[model samples]
Target: MRILAVLLMLTMLPVASAKEPYKAKPGVAGNITSVGSDTLGNLMTFWADRFKGHYPHVTFQIQASGSSTAPSALTEGTANVGPMSRELKESELNYFASTHGYEPTVLVVAIDAIALFADLHNPIEGLSLPQIDAIFSITRYCGGEQPLRFWHQLGLEGQWANKRIQLFGRNSVSGTYGLFKQKALCNGDFLPTVNEQPGSASVVQSVAYSDGALGYAGFGYKIAGVKTLPVSPGDGPYVKPSMVNIASGDYPLSRFLYLVVNKPPGQALPLLEQEFIRFILSEEGQKLVERDGFIPIPERLIRRQLNKIAGDV
Candidate 1:
C-alpha cells in the first residue's frame, strides 16, 4: 500500500493542529534516553527539547547510531524511547515479543522520504529503479544486465561522460540501507564499492563535495550543494520527494518515522513516559515535526496512537 494512504490518509493535508493541547502533569520529571535512527536524531532532539519546556527537570540522552540499535536498546531497557525510520524486522519484533512477552508499542511520529542526492553539478534528469539498482547493488536483480560504474552510462555527456559514479550510503546497521536494498535494489546486496558513511549528514556532505557522487539520505538532509534526483519505477513518471508528492503518494519512497516503547499489554506507561507520549501526540509536538523538515502524522493516526497509550490522556 502507498505510505500516505495507509496511515489513515496521511495524504490528506498538513497537520493544522491536534484536537487538544498536551496536558502536562505536575512533577513530571525523569531522564529520557532515546536510541536509534540517525535519520531521526535531530527530530528526536527537537521533540525532547519541546517536552523539556513543560518539564524542566527532565533530562534527555539521545543516540543516533542507526535503526538496528533500537530493538536491542528497547529490549534491554537501556532507552526510554527508540526512534526508528522504518518498521522492525520479523526477527527483531519476534525477539522483543519473546523477551518481553508483549510487542513493543510503535508510535508513528512523522513522515519522511529517502532522497537520492547528487552533486549539484550533475544535471541528469532522473534515474529509473533498475538503474538505481545497477548503480548500488552487485546482483543487479532489478533487471540490470550489468553494474553502472560511470556517468556516461546514464546519458551524461562531455565532461560528465567519463566521470566515475561514486556511491555513498549508510552503514549496514541503518534502516536506510535496508529500505534501499528492499525497494531500489530488489533486495540485492550492495556493491562492495559503496562508501558507507557513519550518519546521514556524512552521506549528504559526501555527495555535496564529490563530483559525480550519489548518496541516499533523508530528505531533511537536502542542502545547497546537492540535488535530489527524481526517481521512478522504470515505467512511472519521475517523482521528486517533495512534501506534496509525499503526501499525495506520488513519491514512491515516502515513509513513516516512529518511536518505539516497551509498554506491556493492558498497562499504562510510567507517568513521565506516558505524559511525554501524550505530548508527542499533541499539537505542539507535531509542530516540532514540521520544524525539523519532516511531515507530521495526520490527526486520525495521532488520535489512534494516543488511544493506544491511554484513553483519557
Candidate 2:
C-alpha cells in the first residue's frame, strides 16, 4: 500500500509537467521571386518543382529575361534572388553598393559546356582550334563553303568541295553568345548574315533541320539528328563536351552557373532558400544535374560553396 502511494505521488509531482509533447511553432511561409538568364531559367524551374514536393506552402516565381536583367531586378527590389550565367560587372557592383548598400553575394551552382553541333549528314568529323579559327574568320568565308566545305579547308577528314557553310547562333543577348564570342571568336564579331536564333533550343532545332548547318548551344541542349564536334588545338584526339569532360576540365568552353543574392534572406525565407541551395549541392541534386544533361560542379567546388555559406551566416 505504501509503495503504490509513493508512485502515485511521483506522477502528480510538478516536475512531471516538463515532459509535454513537442508543439512546433507555426511556419511563416511567403513567396520568393527570382528572375534572370533564360539559359539557366529552365533548370531553375526544374529545381523549383522538386523543391515544392517538400515545401508546399512556399511559392517561387522565376523568370528568364536575360543575364543582363538579374542585377537590375535585385536593384529594383523586385526579386529576392537572381540566377545568372555570368559574373557581376563592375558597373552593376557600383549600382548595388549605391542602392542596396552592399554588393550582391555570388553563388556558383553548376558547370556547363557550350558545344558546337552540326547536322549529322555533314562529313567533317572534328575541328582543331586553328581550323575553327579559319571557319569563323571572315576572309576565308567563301560562299562555296558547304557540307564538307573542303577537307583541305579544315585540314580534317572527308572532303566534299561543293557545299556552302551555314551558320546558326544565339542572339547577342544570350550568355552562350558571350561565351562563344570570348572562346571561339577571339573577340572578333560573328560573321555578318549568320542566322541568330532566340534560344539554345532553337539553335539546336535549326541545326537538326538544316543540311550543312552548324550552330552552338549549351551542352545540355543537344538533341537528336545533330552531332556534337570534338574540338582541340594542335594535334589531338579532340574532346567532346560531356558532363565528365566538363567537370574534369578537359572541355575548354565549360562555364559556371550562378545564383546571386543581395543579402542573406531573413529568417523564414532564408531557411527555404538555404534548403534549396543545399539540395542543389547534395548528391541527389548533382545526380539530377547530370541527368538533365549539365555537369555537376566538382566535389571540391561543392565543399568550397558549403564553407562559404557557413562563413556568410
Candidate 3:
C-alpha cells in the first residue's frame, strides 16, 4: 500500500480514469530489456521510470534503434519487450513464430499520428496525400504529374515563392519511414533528394532549421520551431491530427503503438513484463500517452489489450 500511495502522490498525470489503477504485484524484480522504435524511445523511458516507482529493484535496458530491430531481438531472447510504432511485418511475424513455435503477443498501448511538419516560418496551410507524394516521391505514384520542388509550386507568394522546399525524413529502417512511404507516397520510392535523419526528433530539428523545409515524423515531437500541417486524404477539407479526428479516421495517417512480447501459447508472461503491461493499460499509463502529445486508447480498447496478457498476470 505504501508503494501505491507513493505512486498516487507522484502521478501529476491527468485523469482519464476509465480503467482501474494497477495494483503492483509482489516479486516483480528483474532487469527488463527493451529494443526497437525510435519513435517510442521516450515513451518507453517514461514508462520504465514510472514502473520503477513501484518496484525500486526493477531496472530497464532500452535500445531505441528502429522498429525493424524489434523482431530479431525478441526472437533471440535478448529483450523482454519490443516497442514498435507499427505492426510486425509478415516476415518478422513468421520468423518469430517459426523459431518460438508460437505467435508473439501484441499489446496496443496508445494511438499516434504520423504528422507532416514544416518550419514555423512557413505559411503553407495543408496538403493532400497525392500532393505529398508529388513532393517527396520521384515516381509521383499518387497520380501527381511532376515533382513539386519550390515553395512557389505549393502556392506561397513573395519571398516564399523563390525558396526551395527541402525534404527531410526518417531513414529506411524506421517504421515511420515505411508507413509514410505506404500512405503518403502511395508505396512509391522516396526521391533521392530526401535528407533522411536518424530519428524523429532529428527530422524535426532538420525542419526547424530550414525555412522552406517539410518533414514527417510522429506528432509527439511537436516543438516551438516546427508546426504540424493538417493533412487531407485526397481532394479537399484537410483534417488536423486532433484526438477527435484521429479516432474518427478523418486523419488518415494514424496508427496504434504496439508492444510485442514473445509469449508461448498456454504459457505465462513473465511477471515483470506482465505487470508493466498492466500498468500501461491502467489509468496512469494512458495518461502518459496524452502527456506525451499522443492520443490515449479508449477504456474498451484497454480491456481488450488486458485480456491478451490477462490469465498470466
- The number of clashing residue pairs in model 1 is 0
Error of 1 at 105 (Å): 0.8
Clashes of each: 0, 5, 0
Clashes of 2: 5
Cα displacement (Å) at residue 95, model 3: 0.9
Kindly report the root-mean-square deviation of model 3 from the true structure over all alpha carbons: 7.0
How well does each candidate superpose onto the true structure, as a TM-score?
Answer: 0.94, 0.80, 0.92
Candidate 3 ranges beyond 4 A from true positions: 1-18, 311-313
Residue-level lDDT of model 1, residues 157-197, one tens digit each, is 99999999999999989988888888899999999999999
Model 2 regions more than 4 Å off: 1-28, 137-152, 155-160, 234-237, 264-269
What lDDT would each prediction earn against the true structure? 0.86, 0.69, 0.85
lDDT of 3 by residue, 79-143 (tens): 98999988788899899989988878877788788999998878899999989999999888889
lDDT of 2 at 132: 59
Highest lDDT scorer: 1
Candidate 1 vs candidate 3: the TM-score winner is 1
lDDT of 2 by residue, 1-313 (tens): 4321232233223331211221223352567688887778778887777766656777889988777778888888898778877667789889988886767777777778788888787777777655555565454332223323333455434444444667888777767777777666665566675788877888899989875777888888888899898877446778877766776556767677788776643322365565667767777666767777776665545655555555553
Q: Pick the candidate with the highest TM-score.
A: 1
